[model samples]
Target: MLDREPYADLPDLPRFDLTSEDVTDGGPLARAQLSGIMGAGGDDVSPQLSWSGAPEGTKSYVVTVFDPDAPTPSGFWHWCLSNIPAGVTSLERGAASDPPAGAVRHRNDGGTDEYIGAAPPPGHGTHRYIVCVTAVDVEELEVGPDDSPATVNFQLFFHGLGRALLTGTHEEQ
Candidate 1:
């Protein structure tokens, strides 16, 4: 596996506290977070996430799950939920199927607007799934269900006030 830090090139912004009940930084993801759709033999469920201490002026939030170690040039995006109201700080497991009102679930690299879970190719080594919660300055990100994860990130580059990250790793034999 290539040793790379995905966010190394991102603009340094204020950081907030992020926690997850079903995932942890530097830890292996549970089977529930593995991709059933991709034949990973696990339940495809979004992890429970919570965050706090967003910077002032934050009006909304964006949650994304990305894997920088995928065998693709641009990596892979497993989930991207945007335009969440700032008042909402936590999501229960499987929230991808029942996002908060006004939040838009953007299509991931898999062409689906929901969490796809992790399914690194067998023998590709461990992959890091980075879960990020970004505090935005607007109530809505102006992106729709048709927008791709890259598009949502483009908007976030301009409007993000702070961010929090939690990572989980997975590997196939």
Candidate 2:
């Protein structure tokens, strides 16, 4: 397994709260959190996530879930959601499976809008799911719904006013 940097350089910003009912920081993902491709009875679902304490200038938010240890140099993005209203601080489980009105869903590495639950190759060792919620200074970023997650990631470095992170891990035997 390769160890890769999770994110690029980000400006110093206020720390915020990011909690999950289905995932714990630095813990293994539940079977339910695994992709349906992993086994029976599983569906690709995003876990319930809640956040708070956005900076004063924040007008919107962006959420990204990435796997840095993937067998690739650029890593892999499982989910990318942009143009979220600042007032919205919580996402129900499976909410990301179908984005709500006004929310922009960018194409992840797998070329999907919905979350693709972790599926580290068998015996690839532990893979980290780094979930991030970024508070942005603008209500909407320049990136569009058809844009790639990497494009949104680039904009985040410039517009993000604050951010919070919650990481979970998964590995197949």
Candidate 3:
């Protein structure tokens, strides 16, 4: 038996499938997109992401990338976006940084409203980037455009109907 909270009162939230061609599980990120500018530091662009099989009642979508292995005990958020139209299924490179109209981009832990590529410490081994696409019941959350990732998450907790997650790992060179 699972010790997690019961969801008997909530709608049956089904799991969706998501994938990304620009990233591989337990693999290294492309050198061109590594954290730290080439010869400086940071990645050049965000990874590509795609998904399918959202629940029938899904009215919108929310995308987020999290790094649990960050130095901070609570972890770090790399990117967050909400209000993606249900018809849309994927995001191209750099989309997280400059999302299309109707979508809202929240500030990451770095205090920037853009995707921050992985930057684990020199000997932290592999760090996972949990990329998620949440099927939401609401077309748009009540959050402001300048809200932070934490605020977005609070809204998501109440609005998410289902979610799909894909994990990619990166290590310092």
For this target, which candidate reaches the highest TM-score against the unseen true structure?
A: 1
**TM accuracy, model 3:** 0.85
* lDDT at residue 19 of model 2 (Cα atoms): 98
Ten-residue stretch with the least lDDT total in model 3: 1-10
Model 3 clashing-pair count: 5
User: Which runs in model 1 stand beyond 4 Å of their true positions?
Assistant: none
Alpha-carbon local distance difference test for all models: 0.93, 0.85, 0.75
Candidates ranked by TM-score: 1, 2, 3
| Error of model 2, residue 61, in angstroms | 0.5
Tell me each candidate's RMSD, in Å, in order: 0.9, 1.6, 4.6
Question: For candidate 2, what is the lDDT?
Answer: 0.85
Per-model TM against the reference: 0.97, 0.93, 0.85
Q: Write the per-residue lDDT of candidate 1 for residues 1-173, one digit (tens) a residue.
A: 66778777778889999999999899999999999999888888999999999999999999999999998888999999999999999999999999999899988887788899899999999999999999999999889999888889999889989989999999999
Clashing pairs in 2: none
Which segments of model 2 are wrong by more than 4 Å? Answer: 38-41
Best by lDDT: 1
Q: Which digits, one per residue and each the tens of the lDDT, describe model 2 over residues 1-173? A: 77765654567778899999988999988766778854523577888999988889999999988989888888888889999988899999987876656789887787778888888888889999999999999988998979988889789888989989999998888
Q: Please, what are the lDDT tens digits per residue for candidate 3 over residues 13-87?
A: 678998888877556666534566323275647788889999888888988888777777567787888888888
